[model samples]
Target: MVTSSILVLFLLGLTAAAVLAAASKVLHVKEDPRIAKVEGCFPGANCGGCGYPGCSAAAAAIVKGDAAPEICVAGGAEIAENIAAIMGTEVSFKEPKVAQNICTGGSRANLLFDYEGVEDCRAEALLYGGEKSCGIGCIGMGTCVKVCSFDAIRLNADGLPIVDMNACRSCGKCAEVCPTGAIRVSGMTMDLLHLNKVDDCLAPCMQKCPAQIDVRTYIQQMKQGDMRGALLTMKERNPLPLAVGRLCPAPCETICRRNIADEGVAIHTLHRFVADWEMNSGSRVRLDCNPPSGHRVAVIGGGPAGLSCAYFLRRIGHEPVIFEKRESLGGMMKGIIPEYRLPEKVVEWEIQTILDLGVDVRNGVEFGRDVTLESLEKEGFEAVFMATGAWKVPGLGIENDDAEGVVDAVTFLDEVGESIDALSGKRIVVVGDTNTAMDVARSAARLGADVSALISCIQRKMSANKNEVKRAAELGSDLKFLTEPVRVIAEDGVVKGVEYRELQYDDPKKATGTPKPVEGTETVLDADMVVIATNRLVDVDALKDQNGEPLFEMDKKTGGIKADKTTLQTSIPHVFAGGEAHTGRNIIIQAVADGRRAARAIHHYVTEGEIPEPKNPQLRVIPESILKNMQVVYNIPRIRVPEISVEERRSTFKEEVKGFVEYDEARKEGSRCLRCGLTCYDAEAGAEYAADPDVSRFDESGKE
Candidate 1:
């Protein structure tokens, strides 16, 4: 009976084994070996940083060709290469990106209400925008910190999460968990090309600055005694910091938060101080460039705009060749600006530093004269940037304007450059009241030319740079306000004098007018030379196409090259124009800004094949009510920039404003900055949101 039972059990076991073997063969599924190998290449943290559910899902997607090999951002380049090897495919990687918190407000952010709830940001954000006046600000409840599996983020004392750049793996976990959408995973190129948005935390000074220099960041760096860092901050936007610092009229200072109190922070002086420190340190600040992109761009005009464009182009891995008409770089900065304002040595040092970064600069190479667009394209230039400055001086509509002694500002400055001593004992009368007029008058006086009169059609208060007008007055130039030059009094084709007339305006405040000439106020002022200090127009004749046709559309109003105001692109898609060529005669800082914009536009055109339109305005200006409410009330006096005595200033061609003598002085001046932001300012400033019940959504009874 036992033997029969054992045999029966053995037969049953054999039947079950045969069934299992059949099932195994029937249910067998084919699997790609690459998927498991790709999975192995991943960190296997199951972080969900790759948009997929986990490493296994991402590996499957990568192996199946549904996703790129570089999909695993957490695993980074090593994993990408390993996956590529496993899949036997080439990997196309994106520019590496890091997560950054875009929101500037933290503890300083205006609060809607004090929250006493759960610590999770997601939970608190559900409660009427998470206690912040700005609806888009970080909730500061450590949700991003919790979601970051790599321990890359930690909350600072301000309750703001600061990402540890070294520990960050470029994963999107923290960004995904951010309730306020403040965290941004951005590429390096995008950061550099970012324009101001309405929602951005831009300061008043930053918005007002044409170059878009981060005035706050540089000032903070200065306060920290990081002179090199401050200079680099400025150079990121304005490549010619040393020159711009010396020449900028300080438009940024006019909108400074400190203006609400005693005076604006001495931004111009501090700006020059940092740049001077960099030059005086004897060691140059060198920036790292990307790998060569195998693209070449032709930049016309070696002025501020062209040099700036070349610097930025070289920085982004493209080769740029600057074709300059002059013997050296620094168009107006070197040639037109007096040596006393922007020294030639300083200009040379800054320009050489830009050229050192693999930029090919060809001096004495005129654009239309030596090279044309067709020739440049034939030479393998991918694109052309026309930055030819406004060099053409329009003729005054007076009789015999071409007299021997009658000359434009450019011609006068050029002759002065040749020999200042030649002007000795010569009588000169400079017309107009612009900054150039003041410069011309002062230069002629220094060279021993008797500056007979500095005449203007407008009132003295309406002239450019009142301080400059004051300085010119101190130098013994006769001021003639509301005086118009009717004609050039010439004898034997020589400028004998200028026929003038006195004018009165209906509105004294207005700079412009259709004045009624006083009947008996007309007079002639004797002069050996008459310098016409008027507007400079773009040399449109120089900008021509291969067929000798107008290369760019012209602005009928200004007669300047008509390009896309934002991108600076010309009628021809691949060509661009900037600086005085497009904007006529603007400030040096604005030219630098144009250069930066053109560089960005050209880069996109070459690499991406299209220039992306800006999502918002280039500059974001906060409301006056908001700005006024955000001021930090303090009566700190503006530190006066050390300058040579008027007696010493007149004797030589030296820099007028001596930069901050000591670093401590600069730091002290920097401290006067209100550190203003979009919706927030220094905490010392009285709280507008909390104090005004009408501004808050919650009732006085504390109910929303």
Candidate 2:
């Protein structure tokens, strides 16, 4: 029996050895001999300094003739020569390139205005060539710093970007990203610096944008019947083109060079036309997200800022769960803007698109109540974004503000937008001179109310947009300027009349000139409803810390959240704030731009583990031609966006701007574009040169 067992064991050992040998022979991969030779000749830094997977992969590719031998900078001339000898090839020595700032002057440069508008360089540029002496000078807005994938640039005290030569990779990313073309890629030596020449007539508007979108490209595309391409070009910079096109205040118009001939080429309208066409044509602009990152982010509020932050986070493969306090999306957009100006369907479409991007929308969930920040953190949320808009209305210091029939402008507008018949046919008095008051008066008039807008400042000094104010007058709404409403007379519990005093302007030239109430010039007007269109404030108490102190605090004086201006982050590292809470009540375009910027800040904070410093922000500059044509008569009636009819609009919560253009109108409007982006390029030089690369090369070769 022992002899038989020994024989079986010996056979088993022999069979196992044969099986091992066969497996080894079948699975063994032939190692590339050239890889080791190339690696040996390399610096062996394994720094991944080259734009490749690793040193081994790069070496293998170099051996296979897939990459240039001179790619490994650390290897230097000696290593390059060695690798070349091994590969049987010669390499040409190339000059090292370093990042350089084209613009020299910084904050010391002269300014045209204070530029107290949006913080974004692009938004500021849209509002009249920015407040710089040189039209192409940097605004110090820091858009490039925000967009840098690597922390290689920073804004100095003079509002100029200081590039870290060691950190810079000469990728030309900063140059491509610079709106003003202020940041250029040149050789480490001074030889290339002399080669860099400035374009004297660069468009200031294009220089201010963060995305560096070629404004002229889309305008040319639109002129060439390539509306689809025009829209696509815009989408390359901003995914929510339609929404921005519809609501953007068009700072670009303020600095348009064509204003010298006529009103700025209705650039916003052209953008809207192409954007709407693309949407209706079923070309949805959806972002391609990375694979699931297994990380989660909780975004509070569904306003533009929160939604924008969530959208960008999802694009980076992070799971963002938006906790909206309201039942629907578009926090202030749905609540504040009337349906006529911005339709529900449009808002719904935008929100749905964001939702479709893998963002988990949890509506009707109030932050701090339904889900606390601490609770979210415990639930595995790596980061949180607080974008709750300023919802509280500022009160007028008048005595009868609390009287019946007295209403806050925001509350009244929200009610009217939600239900038009809430107080229809009632005589309404809107106090204040800003756009909100104008919008309230116009909306009330359309709702069948006898609307009267009273302004403390003179007609010329009113804060409302002149075009919108004129539209209100054309719509039969009474606009009383230089009349300040001081006392509200109440009969029993309801408001009976409003007593106003006339005022005289001290300076007729300024928009907010000094005004003095004229003695013995009091008047009374009968009204059933009085809406105070004063100011909007944020409720920071709702966002409290563990100790019950406000987690995200704002300056008591300015009401701006005490947060990093560049990162949009509050004192709390995980919490970020934006929009009305940071900038107060501003234009929709500015708000949208802020949201987009905040998204970038939040992305870096969560992933890169560092808050990027602000860099030189570009400012928009109005051309002399555009300034010459800024006559009051040059203002053409704004092309109203298409909407449902007034009759249909009043019956339900439908839109009211029923004026869509056909293909012909759209084309004509597109042609009317002054081509704001064109100013950036030397049109004379560009026209002289051919756009086709092959044709230009052929011409050059023939000349040679």
Candidate 3:
């Protein structure tokens, strides 16, 4: 019975095998052998420049009528003709093209600032716009080198990228990865003729940036709807984006490339959007550092430079403790700058991030008095960074300068900035054409004071930023330019008015060619109070040694510590100075730059115990050749930044620059960026590698 069961099971298995073999032959859809023959003719580059997935897929698609013979760019016409013969179809080829660097501007372009971030194009592009002064130039980083599947592109001696036309397959990877649009493929027709198109060079606006943030990349990130990415990029250099975004003078806009076309791009307005978005989203930058290096750095002054020093020092595994002789951390940023120009909340938010990076701030501690440099060294501090900002404003040296009701610009702004109501119902006259004078005049006017801004120079020659001049005028301040005050008139030891004379210059256009007082042009301008804004005085007395000698040599002209231009290091190897202590009262961005340099110098000294020589931040200068290669842009109107009407702004201390830009507005403004560094090239069907008719001898039907 077992033998009979086994025989039946074996016969059933045999029948099942017979049916499977028959079904395989009947149901199979055979792949055309010609498809394999056609795919073999391709160069196997698999570059998507042909608009297909790969060579194999492209081969199948061609035989099935889904793809054309001209799709393989790397293989060119020869491969197309060979594939056509295999498929028994006629073929026509589109001229093949190669990639090229469009921008000729390399080291020739002016650099906005020195870049020392990640050595990648994308990473460095996120830095204050980019290190290159030209917004659209090769960053000189080897991202294209690393990204290319074929080793075709290399950086030239001047740090600009060059693509080898012979090896480039037009994969478009380098162009896709370029942050500054410094690489691209050539046009097919142009490639056939060996004509490569080059981009125009340099965005002068980017060159004007002190912080050197890549304005182009940040805007590109924003346009792609990546708010967090934009914020992260801004934070790389500007730790206090929110504060500076509202208050900066924005020299960048003055030299904007868009100016040649129409109005300048509203850079600050777009920055405000990025800053506000980050603050609203509660986005916090995560700090990553190496293990503590067991070094302690003492940073004097909690102003921009000092704060910047502490912030950067902490990031590099050092412990930084800031000593501020104030109730709060920010020196002038918190005390003197008014809430409207830079709101109290924004100040708090921006500085708070620096403090959160493990920085220790000891308020009410004066640098030399509370903690002397000698004492700090004895207490095991590795280095000292002095950044005490200019807290005192110089007197006008006019008669009765110290009379009652006459206040220094710093002291007056400090008081009024805290309470705008303090200037109500008073007549205020500010002496000098400076940021302080403008702020004081504007603030006093906003608080219902009859205000006048006095300047010794002509209106066009005033050193103050043009925006400040315009805003003060719009706020109803009497802008009396070219009027020099000879003395402050006093009554009962209080300022009653200022005695001034109209001065005539030899050249009306020149501000500093010796002025002669016009005969009998003396006049008294009445005032209830006078605020002097002549010059900034660094508080060096606080940082002086016990014997009345300063800790560092003085600059004499700037009235600050004499330090190296790039290193920010004082004469002492272990000591560094920055901000007002080194440069007097310059721009806030300058102060930040000083602080960053001092931090690096201090770190080098602390770790290596040797002072580093000052080196200028290197940037590639755009050549005159490309500078003359101008691209004419169509008139695309710039986005207008909406502001509070004059009526509403005068009544309240609310923000006068009212509205921030939306995504659409920001994108529209960003779209106008002329990609200057784009290096695009194309390949041609060269005289060599002609189609071989000998391939027609191969059997196409497979019947042979």
Candidate 4:
């Protein structure tokens, strides 16, 4: 038994020895001996922070002189020095950088829209660009939070990601995961500056100007020669193209980008050319109304808003009955604008076109007097739109305002339109510094009146468009800046001059309120007639409820209507109000937009019994190339279309500003539009590469 046990033990030991020898010989890895020495000096973190696969690989490269010794960023300066000492190589050092959040704006502090959808930030970004006020701001959708493997980050109450520096190893994973360029690594000394990314491209001149002039559109259009289309486009927005083309303040030119390039485009002259073509060639615009909706609307006042409302209402199959206070249509347009700028015949032609659209005209009918709100209801009208413009002249509150020859600008313009003989040779003093004041000054100067304008604002601070002011100057009118009308001077109830004081702007950047009077700068100017061109006032008593509160009551403080800003509806569900009546005095384009919005609201109210919410109120983005290629031009001198010669202008109230471009010019302006509707595609080829798991991962061979 003893002999058998010994033989078994010897055989077991021999088998174990043979197995160990075979394993070592077959699975041998021949590594350099210096690699062991180099790796011993490392921190042994195995963090894979160095560019190589691992610390072992990094050690091998350093031993072979293939890689620099100071490659491990996580070990930093101390580890780098140790590796360099073992490698027998010297290396320069750099301070490590840390990731930072540059924007101070967070969800709790910055205004943000509620976005409910997919959990992924990429999916949310596809919808309206992630709901931030600024286009380029952080979405704070927690993308960085999810990508952090070390659990080193937490989203604050404000939805902003806060990084815990202690847990952070500078892995750079959060920066790669952020969809927006919100996360960035920088030196400790770096100071971040916030950037504004709101799109201000479609503001002021581009959107607010009447005639939908697409001042940019026509500049590019006229540069190309699609004159007929350009003319048609102009007529689409303004029915009285010839009149607006001739006398609009050209607000677009005042804010023209080309003004920085030396001069502004001649937008008004191009408009005049197209308008004259359509009018002279007997190419009248025809209307196509839908089948009757069995709804009838009553529009009070025949001014721009009223006419525009009537035109649109008729197009949508509703019958519009316009009630004008005067014997003719075109309320303010007919009563206030001089014939030298807008001829009665042009107004007649435009009104005739609206009438052709089946609009019922009830001339010589005044609202609140000849007609009442109850009367319209009794007449079977489904809706009533009150556009009675602020025709009442505002009081200056100065003494002797009731004296003779102290006329309101509206009344003076009305007399000029009527060709009254009283304004032939009188010396006129026009007050205020708006487009209306400029119009009055130019009209009075052309009428042989020695005109002088008294503006409370400085010459450089005039609110009127620069072109209009220049035109007034060219007409030989005297302009007195920083002048305030204290009182009207008179002798025996007859006007003699204006008692005034010079004023100055205290704050140029925030100079919106009343002016500050200069001490001991009181002055008086000699005048035979005084025309007060102050702002107009609106009376909303007619728009009241049974409780005597405004029926369409808006917030008295903010001046914003109580209804939704997008829908433009009033407090009353069935009624909506817009234009100057709701928004005080605004530009023609804003008034037109208000009318259009109100019409849409009324249509929705009548059909759906509720106001429709806007699908998306954000501006659509087109490709940069599309915007760059869009051809916009300005040809006229940014001045009102030239009127009859200075001599002829003073003689009779003839339409001024003759000479328009040919069909070729109009066509060219039409072709310059980039259309602003094309979609942009992603430009990066590697954008889709990150989505593929196989392509994103590194293989055993270290090749991806």
Question: Which candidate tops TM-score?
Answer: 1
Q: Which ten-residue region of model 3 has the weakest summed lDDT?
A: 680-689
**Residues 130-175, model 3: lDDT tens digits:** 7866677777888988888778899989787888888887878888
Per-residue alpha-carbon lDDT of candidate 2 for residues 1-704, written as tens digits (9 for 90 to 100):
99999999999999999999999999998988988998888766564556675779889889888887887745576787888888889976555666777555566445667878767677777766677766666778887677654578899987889899787656566676566666777652221112112342234445444334446567768767887677656754455566666666676666555444334556676777777776677657545565666778888888877777777677656788888888888876776776656766677777877788889989899877889978998999877777787777777777687889898888887787455555566888999887788778878877778888888876666667776677678667788888888789997877998998888767656645478888999999899989988667777677776678876667676575776766678877887777776766766655555565666666666667876664543333433422332212122223445655445533454544433467655554444443332222211212322343321221212221
Candidate 1 to truth, TM = 0.89
Candidate 2 Cα misplacement greater than 4 A, ranges: 1-57, 60-202, 207-214, 225-228, 236-239, 417-425, 508-513, 545-548, 619-660, 668-704
Candidate 3 regions off by >4 Å?
1-203, 417-424, 510-514, 611-616, 619-629, 678-704
- Evaluation by lDDT, superior candidate among 1 and 3: 1
TM-score, candidate number 4: 0.61
TM-score of each: 0.89, 0.67, 0.69, 0.61
Give the winner by lDDT: 1 or 2. Answer: 1
Error of 4 at 379 (Å): 2.4
Q: Pick the candidate with the highest lDDT.
A: 1
How high is the CA lDDT of each candidate model? 0.80, 0.67, 0.73, 0.63
Task: Judging by lDDT, tell me the better candidate of 1 and 4.
Answer: 1
